[model samples]
Target chain A: MSTLRTLGSAAGAAAVVGGLVLVATPATAADTATVSVLHGIPNTPVDVYANGERLIDDFQPGTLTDALTLPAGAYDLAIFPADAPDGSGEPLLEADDVAVPAGANATVVAHLEEDGSPTLTPFVNDASPVAAGQARVTVRHTAAAPAVDVRAGGTPVVEGLTNPDEATLTVPASTITADVTLAGTDTVAIGPADLTLAEGTSTIVYAWGNGEAGYDLAVQTISGMHSMPAGVPGGSAGLADDTSSLPMVAALSVAGLAVAGAGVARVARNRG
Target chain B: MRPAAASAVLGLALAVGAPTAWALTRPEPAAGIPVEQALPAPAAPAGAGDLPALPTVTARDAAPAAAVAAPAPARISVPAWGVDAPVDAVGIAADGQMELPDDVSRVGWYRFGPAPGADGSAVLAGHVDDREQGTGALYPLKDAAVGDEVTVTDAAGTATRWRVVSRQVITKQALPLDRLFARDGAPRLTLITCGGPFLPEFRSYRDNVVVVAEPVP
Candidate 1:
């Protein structure tokens, strides 16, 4: 595979192939949904189909697809092992009657069930506006291990997170040291890595894999959804007005001269 | 000492007590801006879980990341208007609006938005005029015409050029915030300043002078 993976949309965020970067465009129109796919079952590389059409080819574990804009509705989804002939075979995972709401940002993942069986789970991503200098971070558990607590700076930010469930937090934008510990215990399960939460973005982190196979994280980012300024008070004086009279212009030149004189005097004082 | 020198100069200008023009366009270094607030504790956790075990991430654990990072903009200029100004990063102000620098000579880039050369609208705002000073760095923006060229230089000294495509005088209430501050779209440059009749009672301009520029590929 080439080192560079290109997202379909020109406006879409860039996606990192085998690591942790996936930027998405939020769905804002009322009739379409923005959706992405994450292949998270360890060592299981598969092809994904939606409504009998091939959507993702050779989708590998720990990788996330770019956001797809689809009309709001229900669709059948099927997954086949990589290189399966034209979606004709027994499927590894199937989800029927999956409903996608209009103007929603969502991600569907093929991950491990708590008992170690593979399953398909759909999650609606948060698309609400964030304040300036703030970011939204969402954590999803898709592994087959027991519940765990998510910690930032050694303190629990999320408690008792189980498989296929997710938690979200809106916090100031900064690089944070994060780790996952067994629920109510100090046993480190994952992390202690520094995650850069950029301002005005939603960063979704997925914990996927089974205890037997080992676990890993994949990150998806959604940009845009920053609050507008109350107002831009850019002009305090009316001098920029185009309709100023001749006298106003003359006075302005006088003021300019006075300012220039003041500047000269200040320079002289500095020399002294 | 700098403050005293500035006040003395300002005092002389005020003593003149004459009508002011939009001069003082030289870009000066931004000063007295407050430090950004520290990141607070994460907001309350929301949503439910399905399954999970912890995952350890390290430099050795994954493939090398190849994502592109845009440099921060340091200055902006327009040859058409003879305008040059320092760029300062600003976040939300105390009133929840985009913040602007106290000095009119420097332009404030909306730090939360996409940076220039990124695939989204990169917004920069500057004062059109100030009460203490005469004209602002962006005071000439109201007269901008289509085809004018704008150049933004990043901290790394890379300069990106843009061509003015449109200029509008929209009432503050009617400003289209969605397009002006869009997060996903073809990369563009958006410049803003106050315009229209100045309301002495409210001490503000009634409208915003918005200039949209497309990247010069």
Candidate 2:
């Protein structure tokens, strides 16, 4: 319980300034997934690679994640230091043969050992997929779960699942609309997902992270997120609009000041 | 006078070219204080039941730093939200973050909240401690109830009053989202802090209790 509270506090701090946090949702036909992953390693950047391509590179530990939509299938995942295959100057820790069933959301764990050997584990649901629209998918902990490893489509997205207990990943878009095939239980374990991405069109993954602290935190969170229609460019844009008009006004004011100064000087010269 | 003379010289030279706008180098910090001073706590909010009292000074130690160093806060009073505090003037931090007063034993302005005339809710956050190991201002903020009062006097310019209407403690997983902090109602103020249970080993609060108030008529 104290651990939960400590984790909660840490989660709160990250949520305040870090970025978005995804929780689990019930798996339904039209369900969105809430994918959350955490790189257990602290202060270091970890590159999350899936299908042999870097999804989130140099992702600051503790807060890299995404909520994705998928029809589901087998995929590959890898974990390495940001300056991978060289910087960490080591071999890749691979969590291959990851099979996410149709419509159901799966959570994988990627833990890098002291020696940099990364391990991946899976939690597959058994329930059948819904017949259409949005379904709720919950991602939770397994009896022996290590940490959280999240991916979007076929790419590795989020990591460091500190508290999947309260968050869920929003499932991304998939081609099919019916129920998703599951691996085990009918109910998803985490929470609920938000937003539904269109399947046909290629979509980039974004993460709502709490622990990622650095430059790409914003972009990682945005790129790792499941693009919700409204969450897209709105409030910040409004603020930008207000400030965008400032430079021009400041320019005009300065120009006016200069012109007035020129006029006064001319009048003085005339008097002279 | 010297500034005007310099301006005259520059103005005459500008006629020979498309002059660049004057860009002043950002200001630096005063001595004896950290560039990012800790957030301070405001006086007890109005309508709030007699607040838990804090250690009082003899008004002796507050010299030098109180006068030319910083803009004194205007008297602040909130009838509905239980705030009758004063606000001091402050400059933006060197890093561009809002710089609250270094005293964290009380509720202080969060500088990042809604700026003056912002359409949505504004923010003001402070600490409940005066030290890493001691409790200070806002220590009892989690005890603040809904409908209390919170007023912020922009001593640099005007005195704006705010009323407390809601108070909640949310875990980080469930952040007080844009809906709570940036509401569509009258311009409001939401105060945040890490409170509830103390995780001593972690040196942090377990939950963030948010106290929300709005402008009263």
Candidate 3:
């Protein structure tokens, strides 16, 4: 989960067990708990974790969602940025003692800020489908919270509501997928609009970036927009991997050492 | 000159300072909120056996072992279990991971773990149990006696054996940072493994039973 891995030659700690991509081994019995991440973060290094393990590490901001495999149990969920949870990255958005039961889904949304703290909210939305090349996005902050500036690409598109509970973004018909942004700080690549707009599809809208740490960003596609994924990409809707459970220092040191061990120990001006 | 010896091994139940709780985070921009709350209190996590063994590991993945021919650091003999695996000087992998010789998989020695005979706390680690594949050298560590002879080799190539003073079944979560990392400064060796009746469902041993060996010679 260290950036040094990206620069130097450090083999990813990603261990491929038995030749299988060691993805999250969800709880045996499908728990009713479903957790989704919607962040109002721009240009962030994702570090999402569940049950205290390094699951996702998208250490570069982009809007997306990823599902997790966990046994139904009480979990302490958190989100942070790459390179730090200690002042270097955003503050953690944690839901203490969240219970995930079998066959149920648990949805938790995190909003990011430049100050690096969190104001989390439990986002609830029904599945609505959207069509390809055409998009319908909705965002709202619960209980008259902060205002967030939403951007379509790098340009400002929609402003998050403070007391103005609902906001929406409709992409042009000639679009493939657009990057969704929260506030001015968070941005993510969202949607490969599927089907025809006239052919309405269901997309479950989950927005979470409108609070103190206000900017929980997520997508709410027109129902059935293309084959709607079980959840957003990049692991848990907008829940960028932003937790301290993953070691950044240890990883950086390992990478530096790997380079030094490779007979390049004299790369003076080394910055870990 | 070598540092002066501190307390006798038996008398030293090394008191390692509580490790500082380091908050882990990524390199993303903060979502824009103030963090006024003190970090959640550090916790010694439980339910370790339930955790998976580092998704995967090398059987003897301690690659590019340092100075292998340098005779075993000290003689490690688990009298009751009948193990007499010789300790050797190990080093970091080419990748910088603590690596033991691939030739001697599951053998324990104090690399950066603990020192052999110094004023500081030392460590000893061995494979919990192994044969050719299933079990290797530290196979009998599960049943080692209270007073088993565990010799540690000094940097000068002298052997200093210790007695297995205590055995503990510590979950991986509550790994004793002080004892394993040795911040308090005492010489010791911590034998380790994923052992106890092997759990088929879990695909690993019950807990890592550590045998703290103190210098006797």
Candidate 4:
């Protein structure tokens, strides 16, 4: 649990600067696409190849790669065992002539099918701006498990989610306790874990692994869709004005002190 | 001058005693998994893949270096104004407004925005004056002159310096939020506090004193 918390902090910190977005350079927007890779095939540490060239080496299960800015085009993609001498041998998974659209933000996953066979799935990510103070959370079911319901803070947000399928919701920014249960049943399958939905960002959670191996969660965050606050209400009293009356200041001073004393007392009460 | 001194005294007392009251009210820390470490070379080698043509990947102008994550800012100091205070992370309120700390002494750093040293505008706001706290730590921000330096220290104890570039007291309705809370641009530091006349009906100041600063080389 602590390890997950630490990892969360590290990832959160990395995107804290106004939410990092996988943006295509404006000048080349018509020619480029942004892509990230997630290796969710449990028990397999493999090398990822694109067009017969190794793009990632010894890629571990449940690991997600940083975004790559690639020119928009079609290419053969393959995955091979880590110890494979070259791309000449039969690949564990292969997809031919995968068309990558220009200016697209996508995630390609190597994961298990509903029947527990390994396969590849590409999903177009939602990067549109979310409402102010709200966050977008997308959940993808890539595990071999049966259909399930995803509950946030004890309320089911995604129902009857199936293998290689996804559900998305925009919610308030907060830390919520989330769990997955067998569809329409109280039987918990995974988690009662905490998920933080930060404002203006889209968080994609992947439920991966097979029924035989046990399921785990992986996360990918894309930021930069934040909206401005309606306003900043910074002051209440009229004390900052130069013409403030002496008698009012004196009166407020006493009141302020009393409030300060009460605050300290409240802290003491909380501590006790 | 007398009113300012009286308010300063009131501010000092609240600054010393008020942080604990609001600390208990903040939400829990959120969670995320560690970002993946392996990065592919920007482009595939020419003629490597069976495709119509060799596709090359290039670096994004707006993306930060994915390898090293910058730390969050923990404190801020403006020696010119004798302003130094701890910062608390804050987000948007349910009302679709920026949530300010209940404690007037501590500044609120907009968590969803860029951090102080990151490549965008980093916003730090404080109350100008409140009923419980007579004056805020950023009350002197309106008086900040161009060339004054504001220093922010991150969690790792690295202090980044910013030089005051401009100051403005615009009406609250006309606040240039897009520029002040920008997510993409050169690194900048933005300071905000209440100013102008306070309205009894609204219980808010009419204007916001905004200070913009650029990174100091």
Candidate 5:
């Protein structure tokens, strides 16, 4: 769970960011991990810092950065209001000791929790190839909403998912109508929207924004994880026929005979 | 000299030399495994007494009840080609070409593609032969017929089956790059190797033999 605290004023934000700086390292370095940062807090543009170094300036709300390769480790991240005088104010939100693992592809989101408190949420993306004709859907609760049930085609597919948590399912690919309802209640909190689950893709849906202030949705797609049943090279061969290359054929024949001779020698040596 | 003696000498020559010819006609193995491992093992003497048989064991049957999850593929078998080879995950090389398997006796599974049992096209590629190792595990793919069975076994020992549907010989220069490397489509398995006329000038085969198969649901 993410830690959240209320601040008295913008000036007090700096004290909060300075209070935590845990020096922790990661366990392994087997593979490089890729990470993308998403800013989901409405109307907020932020300057992002990692380990006291400026990573992104003027990171706008509702936008996501391209995946960046990062070594597996723990990182300290802080977000300050855009254009704030350097080191003169507190960060709007800060998270320390975020653990990123090897071979992982993930997104670190700066979004508001239910009740409009800003927080950081880390999501691990599953990029493993999906079975044929199937698509994977993951719903993340990152909005200012209470625990909710996610419905796909009017049936409850994920139950009691609370803020900052997620649920995933692998189903046959299709366009599905999805909606979110408050837990134990049928009242729609957001959506009745159409989501296309393309074959061999993972469609991640984020329920963001403050519910009391009117909740909304954001979708991200990750693809290229599919398995074909057989191997067949597809495409057209440019040449009209094999006859255009006769000299090359002669060269191949000579090469073949030479190899045949060598094979005999090797076999005879092995026997002796 | 006896006819049998003459034939034996000829066969041996072909066995040793064929690998070099094939190697000259195909792309070299990508830098993944050691060069020696990529070469085929030498044939044993013909008159050696029958080797003792090992006990048969099935990984799936012996697995614990808690280990039923689908496992990552570890090996591939194309019965039609008498190929039972190890499988290694391969990534794109710095030159942007798909990296090939380090061992000629093994097949390289494109890491970017879905695992074999997953939906979409899973691609596996191998060398036709090696410069020092004759007849790689996938060498027999050139003669694979439609409806041949291909099996991929996962680390957990679960085996998924596929049946060959089509085979094509396309010039390398004209290969439909996009379609050949598609990530999403009907679940299919594609096997690739060098084929068609060998071009000495280019030191590569002019065409590629592509085999397409579908899950045997």
Candidate 6:
């Protein structure tokens, strides 16, 4: 089940390259949805074919594709080995009629199932703005591991999350230590790592790799979804009452006096 | 301190003594166009079979969930304020300001934010007063007390109830924009309108009355 033990660091390097792609292409049309591709099969470099077109060549494992904004539609996807000649051999994995919704931000991950079979999973990224002082955390179980319980601060936050499944929760923005254990058992499987949940953002943690070889974790962030009133800032200072504030009352009195004085001046001028 | 005093003294000199300027304005709700038109087109209906089955989760747990997609608000009602108004979806204008509802009797739901019952704070704004119609639908929010029930009905007729948790009047400059517009958190609703003394000079109200409510139960 653990075929690509040596390719772990290479996958991390590919992710860095993917991050650069994301920074370079920041213009997405309003009507389109942003779709990113993640190659999770360890130790394998492959070419990705979408709708019969070779979209990515020599795509390394543990790497991500820059988000592509495409019109909402169905596209056939196929994964071919890196050395396989284009259009010549059988695909390593394929999914037909993969649907991409309009205006949704999503990640399609090609990873191994718990049984060590390769599969594709499409996850819709929640782009909804988080409330002030809050963040969203999502845990995706994509490794070849048993059903697991995800704990935050030593308590189970998500339980019975098996491979290719995910659980999400909204939490106060803070740094938390999280660990994964086998479902209903305290035996730790991965992590005592610090997870930073920043305000108005979604932090997605993926558990990858086989448990026997020690599972690995990857983090991805999608930000800028913060819910605030249209025009108000979150840190606004508010007035206690309308009429009683000393400054307000004083200002009103001054204005009243000014208007009265203006009236007197106009009357005097008329009499003159 | 001197600058602050100076500004106050100057304010008196320039005070025109006009009626308080109500900040809320009832612009004609985008002129006969459908309010939902301003929002992103609804995503394509997802096919049931497209999603893979969870390894050990039961069929019931696998059923498509309500939280997957937020439904657009169709109406809003505040029982304590005697407000029962149709909701008009409003988006940000070309000037980057939120568009106001055209109908003085209706409330404008910020379409860019989460829907009323979604995870984030859904915001609804209305005019305090209209030139011809007098008080706007949300004008009574000034008196909204804690525990008042605010119900939002989605297009699918699912009604979610919220209870007022806090209410305050804040100057426009001090308004918490992000909190009012947040799209993720414990589901909440924010009601806002013009408040405080109207400034005729600026032709707008000086403060905003904000009512924050959390989901019931």
Tens digits of per-residue lDDT for model 3, A27-106: 33343333444444444455665556544565333243443334455655456666665334433544445444543333
Model 2 chain A weakest lDDT span, ten residues long: A228-237
Per-residue CA lDDT of model 6 for A134-224, tens digit only, reads 6899998888878999999999999999777788899866778899899999999988787777666888888876644557666777787
- Candidate 3 at A35: error in angstroms? 49
Taking the tens digit of each residue's C-alpha lDDT, what string does model 6 give over B1-217? 3443445445555453322321122111112222122122323433334332211111111111122335789899877778899998876544445667867688888765678767666788877775556667877766776678889998999998988777777678876675566555567787877776665455567777777777899
The C-alpha interface RMSD of every prediction is: 17.6, 28.0, 29.9, 18.0, 22.6, 16.5
**Top model by TM-score, which number?**
1
- Select the stronger candidate by DockQ from 3 and 4: 4
Q: For residues A13-117, what per-residue lDDT tens digits would candidate 4 score against the true structure?
A: 211212122322233255667688888888998888887777887888888887776777675777888888877677787766666767778888788877787
- Candidate order by DockQ, decreasing, is 1, 4, 6, 5, 2, 3
Which residue pairs in model 4 clash with each other?
A8-B32, A18-B113, A51-B49
True contacts kept of each: 0.34, 0.01, 0.00, 0.35, 0.03, 0.08
Question: Which lDDT tens digits does candidate 4 get at residues B115-168?
Answer: 997877888998887898788888887687778899999888999999887777
Q: Is candidate 2 or candidate 5 better by TM-score?
A: 5
Per-candidate TM vs. native? Answer: 0.67, 0.27, 0.28, 0.66, 0.46, 0.47
Per-residue lDDT of A58-152 in model 2, one digit per residue for the tens? Answer: 66544535534433344455667686562344434554544444344443434332223333333232233221112223333221233544433
| Local error of candidate 2 at residue B191 (angstroms) | 1.1
In candidate 1, what are the lDDT values of residues A1-272, reduced to their tens digit?
01111211110111111221123336466566677888878988898877787777777888887777676667777789997787798888776556666676777777886778787766777888887668999998878888989999999999999876789999977778788888999999887667778787888888878777787777788876566666666888988655445456566656756666777687787889
lDDT (CA) per prediction: 0.72, 0.38, 0.40, 0.72, 0.65, 0.65
Better of 1 and 6 by lDDT: 1
Candidate number with the higher lDDT (4 or 5): 4
Better of 1 and 5 by lDDT: 1
Score residue B36 of candidate 4 by CA lDDT. 12
